[model samples]
Target chain A: MTPSALLCQFRLIGLCRKWCSSRAFTCQAAVNQLRREQGATALAGRVDRFGGITVDLADVGLPKDISETAFADLLTDSLGRWKSEGKVAVWLRVPIAMSRCAGAAAARGFTFHHAQERHAVLSLWMGAGESKLPGFATHQIGVAGAVVDESNGKVLVVQDKNKTKNAWKFPGGLSDPGENIVTAVREVLEETGIRSEFRSLLSIRQQHNHPGAFGMSDIYVICRLRPLSYDIHFCTRECERCEWLSLAELARTADTTPITSRVARLLLHGLERGFESIDLAMEELPAVYSGMFYQLYHRQIPSS
Target chain B: MTPSALLCQFRLIGLCRKWCSSRAFTCQAAVNQLRREQGATALAGRVDRFGGITVDLADVGLPKDISETAFADLLTDSLGRWKSEGKVAVWLRVPIAMSRCAGAAAARGFTFHHAQERHAVLSLWMGAGESKLPGFATHQIGVAGAVVDESNGKVLVVQDKNKTKNAWKFPGGLSDPGENIVTAVREVLEETGIRSEFRSLLSIRQQHNHPGAFGMSDIYVICRLRPLSYDIHFCTRECERCEWLSLAELARTADTTPITSRVARLLLHGLERGFESIDLAMEELPAVYSGMFYQLYHRQIPSS
Candidate 1:
């Protein structure tokens, strides 16, 4: 029989086993004995650094025709062995082709970790107390550049073509994956066609359930940027208008976003009482992970 | 034949059709005719408010045994039609049972949008230019509370039992999904057994590629909190030590993380110059989404 036909037969058997839960143990034992006789590979897995067991079903050489009942039996037996071995967590990856097994895992208390192209990962904490697993990223970061020409006392701003309000705001966009705060410089260059260099992070706005972020929280960072070239050449596709407005006038204008007006006032304060008063200076520090580093932004400590 | 056996037959036919690209068109036409004769349900979808199409395969009533080739053909035909209809984006959700269709969709330029337990979502921009679809969340928010005792000029701090370095730091933890900065209050209470109320956001630290965050970026927010009760009943499992240390001493000490030390000085600055000199006060504003509100953190605007 073709593999697909065999799969059908196994599904039928699995359906029957589901209705006869009392006989499941005997059926599972028989299947296991048959598998041993056929020299079929046992479910394979590896131990993670955290003493957790990770099983990728696609790479485990599962029989294409294995029934859900048999798979569940194998999983239960494995969990019992792993628990005795003091495994802390179990990470299970179920390929799309063998997705029927996900239900079995879920019934055994597995919950989703994250999903990718060809598979879905489920996790369970087998250790004592609450699960210590860190969750998936749940916020999007948007970096905007407030390009100020100190010589002229003007700042570059734009009105997006797509937005209904068309309120003047800083030229900005979402930060790409693995991008740094310097992404604000690129966003400014793209939207207004002006080159700038990142100086210091000025302000951060944290909002939850952002409409544009597809129901995720948003972190908007405004950076103080020093303009390199002062010519205006904005992208017509993204912005309706772009200009260099007087910083003082922008701060008092009613025709801009609240954030823009607020940042304008902040820039005014920074200008009058030194940028150090408002700047969250970036400092690179070695991360806990050896040979790796991360950027830390905080108030600059005055040199003693 | 059972649905599973029919699925197998579909796979065999799809495999054959894949090898015969020249005859694939004719085969697809025949399949379409067969579908019409059998009165199979047409692919169902809805147009979102943004003029994008969303097709959930689980709810679309696809044939139980539809071949991959046929699914691909249908998707291609749909794309052409939707493009002519001026659809901006196409959101396709494929359930695990029909994940074989994912490859066919990907070949036509569909990329992963996000994934969930039962289905994975793929997206394509059918508009004039680049896809405007917002990306999935890519940063995790960690909120920490620095609880200050105004009477004694002391701050609450802790050293984690699990970390190699038992450095003094504010008691805090990861923000739960949809939780506000006020989560810091809860985390402080849980870790140090001190009840506190959130006063103002003090500082934000943005870091990328956090080791503990599964390769995602992290945003850490620190909030100033006032102590409600000052009894030290720390959770021994999570902390090695907890104490109320002098604010001035923590700022001058070398036995703490750089961030903690910097925040200590910031708090000291606040003590001397007033918190308005450093605080990012929270303001609740109506979000663009009707009936929704979001919290904005920025320098307080002085009442005119």
Candidate 2:
């Protein structure tokens, strides 16, 4: 890293330390509260974020305690927070022993975030010791989409071509070679010409349900954007149609699929709040653009 | 990149293609706009981002426009955009004819981002009447801090070690070799035992204004984080006493630095946003981590 970038990072760390130092006392207070009620399992998962669901690796059940209901609440809360303050995704691994209970989650139709490779090894290491754990590698990637036009209570939607005709979707794609999710969103826009802005992170839709898709799709912090201009373009003939449609119109669209429900809800709710554009620092343009470039020119440009 | 990772990426590519097909029409709209805008040079001088700033062969200034307002705007925008984008520096060339104009930027109090490297290079072409543009490399970096408490509002703060213990600062040190801004942040946190969440990316402070310290300082993305837990881990004592301070109480302690202005504003806004955490795919982690580790520890650690 360049000296300037290094220095910038150092500054953030310092703040984290300082923040932790002050919160140390509070953590101590909560430690006791957590220890009393949740036992070791509850205590382990005590880092409760309001409107944010915390997966308790200890329980590992389908339709886990944090279900669609909890997810919706958390998502709403998160979207509000993300509007002004951008959102971030943090991926961490729980030790196999700590995460073993999560394995049972599959029976309830719950899937571990990185179940195939990372979680697989973790489960084996914890349940069957080192000998039984299959050796493989895994990585978690987060991709986000920015809703550029949510004017007239209608969200801008892109109809993908590779899939069924008339199906509505978001104007975003997958991560690129050597790029991250934020970049992926930017790339999709630059290619698709849907001037978008990030709104709130939608959901981390893993590949379990869509075995056809494979692995996991870490949908990033979604956002609502105001397209400066409506003229759409395709760097390549990737998508069939990009349009601005009202939430009700989208619902009534004959081609709307069940998959679009989440996006529909997000857009409808965002429209009600009257989304605002977030200030983007010029310096940040490079990363955003480059990230998009990586996604477009070099990334696994997403399909229908 | 490993073979498995490559395969996984291919799968993702297929998914992207399908997504693109579904949204082809929307993409065409954006494509038209892009075609119209292509003739305009407003997008000129813009760098190509390939994980870092890349000065496209076409955009790097030719001699005539070097000292023009457009030139300055391009440079300023580039600097501002890249800096905010979290890039350490930008690489470009000053056409040999524009060598005379180099002083123009310097005269305007604009300094090269990096002082250690040769500022410019002269190149000779093999063809007749053909001359190569001279080259220059400059770099910049920023540092950020997040102050948080367990209650999600407290963080440890300190007086600058270099300063006379009057200017309150985060307990972070300069970045080391082979590290990104995030790496720098991690290093500082490891040394300080402070856990931080990335918040709003702050300004990329000018390095010329290094204060009493040896190196320059820029305002990075500073944030407010909730401390999770703390341990007395040390990477050698690098600070004076560290204290947890509430955001409300920071100003009461010492006059906050101009660098901290954004942080203070963010705190006052009562915005709760999480900082960005990098997402690397699970199947690709070993190789990615290994690449970094190899550079730093190849000689130290024996390959299995």
Q: Point to the candidate with the largest DockQ.
A: 1
Tens digits of lDDT, candidate 2, B92-149: 4333223222233333333222111112211112222432222111112233455555
Native-to-model Cα distance after best TM-score fit, residue A151 in candidate 1, in Å? 3.2
The prediction achieving the highest TM-score against the true structure is: 1
B256 Cα displacement, candidate 1 (Å): 2.7
Determine which window of 10 residues in candidate 1 chain A has minimal summed lDDT: A15-24
True contacts kept of each: 0.37, 0.00
Please give the lDDT score at residue B177 for candidate 1. 74
Native interface contacts retained, candidate 1: 0.37
DockQ of each: 0.25, 0.01
lDDT of 1 at A259: 81
